[model samples]
Target: MKKTLLVFGLLLAVNYMFSQGCSDAGICSINHGFQSEDKSFKSTLELAAIYSLGEADVGYFSPYISYTKRFSERFSFTSKVTYSTAHGSFGTRSQFGDAFLIGNYTFKEKNKKQWSTLLGFKFPFTASNLKINGYSLPLDYQSSLGTIDLFLGTNLHYKYWDFNGALQLPIVNLNNNSYFKEYGGTNDFPSTNLFERKPDALLRATYSLKTPNKKFTFKPNVLFIYHLGKDSFENIFGQRENIKGSDGLTINGNIITSYSLTKQSSLELSLATPFVVRDSRPDGLTRSFVLGLQYQYSF
Candidate 1:
């Protein structure tokens, strides 16, 4: 009975993590480019939790918050913060935090079909004290590379359809060299020369239909992502190897329904699924199903 209860609890936690943002490869990207009219401030909050079943039991939970303000008809600014936790059956756990700043500019005139461009930077600040499968990994082992991301994207909005696309470039990387040397089992510590670069590109499109009363709407969206570059690993004993691979691509789709509760409040539910995956890295997991709920308020 005790074992059964523990299993049930773990399942619940995994489910929560899945909802929060567990990709099959353990990477999470939060998309929040949906926009609003000018001269308005919008805020949104979301939460997701997940669990991994089978021989290897793992669970994760993540919570995120975002705020955006439109300064003029053609410009806007956004800020976001997120926290995440991960746990494994062997009693290992890890946590991380991320923040982002974004600026958007419109190239077309107001009330006309136009294109908007977005530029952004992401800062990953992480601290973890967790064992990996009972092995005492250093606190820095679980940290991200602390990268600076350069974003360039354009959004096209028409009466019934919308399209968005972006490319992500990593301009700077800051990681503890000793951590990679120890874990990767090489003596290449303190040499930043062995570092590599990775980049990503994304494209998304959506179609929407509004109800007669204009209080409810249905939207279907499709997203495509491609990953490029190489990751290097070295051992404390001075052995080194570079993992080189071609770009990987994935396609996903989502259906979302939104209902207006009042003039300034709305509720939204979204269901998403992975449609196509190609050239997946052996060590990475692909995203499966995703469900999300969001609440937005304007003041």
Candidate 2:
């Protein structure tokens, strides 16, 4: 039975390698509970590739590089950068996404329980407006949201279980162009020009199951996200209109599996799919599914 399950898991991971998606906003990238707790390692480096399929057949391919530095037993900092490309029927567009700088502070770690706080900043690298063939592309085709965002969150670990909560807020909004609105009556895309996005809150729970030899670990997690307020977009008449049904909840199920290759290196595979979705994702953050593969090195 164990061998059967292991083969099934491996097959699933390989099949999903071509897609990736998650936390449509920014909270999903905060490195909530995956940081190394081993004090012996002063720093670690990670390289990850992700593929996501969104509504309207839009596809995203993102490559990420991240570095984490352990300053002390209870403090650490992480920095990550991503380059993304979007392709679909409209064409292809690629650019640098947002950059993330996160700090984690542990408050307690005793008797198989740990508590930590997270604070981070998201710096935009693009204007969130990309043009293909002289046509404005939607948010799904853009790499960045073009906003300076603040992230605050907390994580609690008890034995093999993990719980996390977070909030992502835009401190500065720079996305104001009408994405694909210029194409107008010629296309079926939604109006996202001068898009104004709202804040999002996240909650996640996960359980880790490990093999007897400790070489393999499987983590299954459920993620919940709530859009705080309705998003708005400028209409052709030059008036801001609220996107109805935009403020709602989304629930997703995710699985992450890891294999230890050596003392200093490992490989991770993750897949995510939504169980519940909101009606209007005007921010163009909607994802049908996400898959990722990552390699990590520690020293």
Candidate 3:
């Protein structure tokens, strides 16, 4: 019985690791480190292919380009642009994704431990005016929610491990062109989604490994996110509708592999999958696989 208990405990620990990942669904970058690659200039090009089955069916491909520049050892800036092509059973569409920018500052370092903070903003670029057969497409079919978001986070690095946490608040999310009418056909005219979103929080931990040849590195991580509840929406019929069941928790396990082809160039691949979930998740994710390939160059 003691042996069986020990095995069960080990399994539990593995399950929890996947839940602590630092990345989220909206993130497009593949660089998951605590600092800016410890260099002065870095350029990254990444392509992500995501297949989401089950309740939400989608095939999405997004390309991300990022440039991180360092002025000194203590501070760096990163700017990334993204575009996506997506297809579903209903139809196909392509659009530019949200713009992502972040400034990183490292502070509080002593005894092989370092702390870094990230302050960033995402600009609104996606348009939500999508309709098929004269009816509004479901929210899942829209490529982006068109929100300007602000982000703040910090990372703690100790040896070969990193603990990262972040919060994202959507300050402005508005798309007045199309409206999703209430189900069951209420007595109100269709109105756009005018509700403000709650803050989304994430926590992740990553452990890095280097190959004996010093040409490759492996990183495995766990991520967890808590999506807070949404606000109420005012309808065209002078009524307020409270959207519920939209708050929940999710956990994912991700692995990233990198190979250095040369001193200035490298390639990376990443995979993420969710394993556990809880609470009322209206329009929640059932299961998904995000596969990514990234090429990096530094000079």
lDDT of each: 0.54, 0.80, 0.62
Q: Which candidate number has the best TM-score?
A: 2
Model 2 scores a C-alpha lDDT of 0.80
Candidate 3 lDDT, 1-299, residue by residue in tens: 34643554455456444432222435323234345573544444434444433233456676777777776678777777777666666567677766778888888679999999888888867555566666655444455556788888888899988888888888777543345456414322223455444667888888787888979887777777787664345566757665664466777767778899887778888766666664333221233556678787777
Best-to-worst ranking by TM-score: 2, 3, 1
The 10-residue segment with the lowest total lDDT in model 2: 14-23
lDDT (Cα, tens digit) per residue for candidate 2, span 1-299: 46745754565455444333334777865754345545788888999999888867788899999988999888899999989999987789999988999999887678888889999999989878888877787887888888889999998889888888999999999985566455644354568878888999999888788999988988877789998999888888889889898888887777889999987888999887776778777776777778899999889
- Candidate 2 lDDT score at position 35: 53
Q: For model 3, state the Cα shift of residue 177 in Å.
A: 6.3
- Over 56-172, each residue of candidate 1 has an lDDT whose tens digit, in order, gives 233335455777777777777777765555444335445555577778887765686878788888776742223465553322233334456677777888887778888877777
**Model 1: CA > 4 A from native:** 1-31, 38-57, 90-94, 109-112, 127-145, 177-197, 235-240, 244-246, 282-285
Q: If both were scored by TM-score, which would come out higher, candidate 1 or candidate 3?
A: 3
